[model samples]
Target: MTDPSVVHAPAPAPDRIGRLGAGVRGLMQHAEEAAGLAQRPGLLQGLDPRAKVAGAFALILAAVATRSLLVLLALFVLATALAAASQISPARLARQVWIVVLGFTGMIALPALILVPGTPVLSLPFGLAITEQGLRAAAFLTGRSETTATLALALVLTTPWPQVLKALRCLGVPRAAVMILGMTHRYIFVLADLALDLFEARRSRLVGRLSPAEARRLATGIAGALFERALALSSEVHLAMIARGWRGEVHLIDDFRFRPRDGGALVLAAAILAGTVWAGSVWP
Candidate 1:
């Protein structure tokens, strides 16, 4: 005799659960790696975040101002050297910075190769031709993007998030902007963890593989629930922060001092920028 009270549920799908687990673990591992990198006793890591932020900005400006491909290449090399000095692996930079910048910039530059007018370098079907001017323009665009991204990534990887935010505040960025950036950064991780929890709970409760329509509905529901939870969490967090007397100002245990090394780094960055500008002007 079958028990009327008993309910049968289908077995859970292994693949879906495995993918969710892997994605969450990968994200957490990446965050941990970034934190570890910032703590390393490397050249950039030792310098004050203020100096690093300034230097990175100067380098990025140099990249943007330079028209010569050679100058951009030089900046990219300098960025790579700085990354090496900061104990950041080339593979990590390639995976995190280079690949992303190149992929995005490449798509934008591809159309320019056929659209811009100049001496024809290559002919293609559909009355398309790659021109010298177009090729140069595309190279310039892609190289500049890659150089700037490298410099920015180096700064981010070497500096802790809190210190970076504090450095921005010290550099005369508006207090409101700094506060927003800090809160956003902190909340991102908090929300990520919350999302992971939600996914896990859903996975546990899931009985079997969902049909395409069922999957879409489930995803939509999850998204709506996540948004609602995030709103409530933000409110509670704001109240808790107020209770703890957190004003709009950011504070850290170690106050930044402009050491001699930081001064030297700033000087070096200025010299590099000057040299790059000169090279760009003289390049035929």
Candidate 2:
């Protein structure tokens, strides 16, 4: 008989820089989003994730349906307002959009689309002559891409993580996805805390620069630690489930209801969408 724990478990990182970098970035983004914010909801947090999601989609659809710069401009303003009301810091919100801004900026730069697909000019000191058509296409593409991204960020900022997950479950989102989210959301912080602790301990113990072998060993140790922690959590959860009631089918608690807020939320979303679309039509 094989040791089930050792056989099936993922191996720890061997001082893996790539995996560690990814983990650290994700950890920082979450910490930055929630840190130093008020404990209670300001106003937007009171709104349901579904409501926020709906509003975001409406904004996106309106922008997508119309190529007018006016519609895209409306989406930009609406998205910024919603993000502000979420109570997260401007820095954090900027972090969310950092990638979008960078990517779009690069795409619009003179050297990108101006250069033909097959042609490569080694020396164009002044840079390629970007055509008017290419510039317009780039602008249009950037606007559409940014509209969707802003919607996603707004939904994330305004909607509490658990409520977002719950809303997804309520909306008949796949059980597998819900389960993964449920488990990950609950334990992500725990893993982050553990990683931080381990890192601090290792740094404190370090003397001189480590050898290549030592670095690999340390990387592997971190991965091993994460794997064990996750597996232990899974076992604990499984045991608790068995203790209460053994069943293959999972159940979601019935907590959501059609309150007056729901209607009000939808009305506000409709009004914003309608007003934006109407305004787009009139803008010369």
Q: Which is the leading candidate under lDDT? A: 1
90-178 per-residue lDDT for model 1 (tens digits):
99899998999899999999999999999999999998999999999999999988888888889988999989998998899999999
- Estimate TM-scores for all models: 0.91, 0.65
Worst-scoring 10-residue span by lDDT in model 1? 12-21
lDDT of 2: 0.65
Task: Give lDDT per model, in order.
Answer: 0.88, 0.65
Q: For candidate 2, write residues 158-243 as lDDT tens digits.
A: 66566677677666688678767767766777677667667766766777656779878987897798788878977897788679
lDDT of 1: 0.88
The residue-level lDDT of candidate 2 at 29 comes to 75
Q: In candidate 1, list every pair of residues with a backbone clash.
A: none
